[model samples]
Target: MNWKIGLADNWRRLHTKGTVVLSGGLALVTAFGPAIIDAWNSMPPDLKALLPQGIQRYAALGAFLLILVVRYLAVRRKGGGDGAA
Candidate 1:
């Protein structure tokens, strides 16, 4: 059964302590997962040599910036007042 709590009241209950803890936990998981994945992904010998160190670092930085941009767009879309006239 789906028992989603309503946020219409008690915003503080969600925002004060619970949200901070939840966010911190999720941030840890998100960060740690990528590190593990990157370690495995960098293991192959031929593929690593093909990309070269400098290009791979630049590409990784660009991918991170793109992720941030996508997240900003998603937040804006959710909170853009639905483009109401």
Candidate 2:
């Protein structure tokens, strides 16, 4: 009974949560991006050599976050600046 509605609601909640989480992450990266990049670069030679995958993942995370925020803002602007959507 009403499982479809429940599923839609769950998906909506997940998407909204992702938007908020990614927005915050994007803001953080914008604020302290240099430090983050610096720390990543400062990893020891062996560690950097060993953890290329992890390093790439975090860099991707940062880029993904940046894209999310830009998309969100673009959508919001398109909807209108009346604080509607």
Local error of candidate 1 at residue 17 (angstroms): 22
lDDT of candidate 1 over 4-83, digit per residue (tens): 97665756654544344545655675688778678858788887787666874685576566555644542224546759
Give model 2's TM-score versus the native structure. Answer: 0.40
TM-score of each: 0.30, 0.40
Instruction: Kindly list the per-residue Cα lDDT of model 2 for residues 10-85, writing each as its tens digit.
Output: 5755555646667677678679978988997887888777765666678767788777676666343556767756
| Per-residue lDDT of 75 in model 2 | 43
Q: Pick the TM-score winner.
A: 2
Q: Candidate 2: which stretches are off by over 4 Å?
A: 1-17, 53-58, 61-85
Candidate 1 differs from the real structure by a C-alpha RMSD in angstroms, to one decimal, of 11.1
Poorly placed runs, candidate 1 (over 4 Å): 1-30, 33-38, 71-85
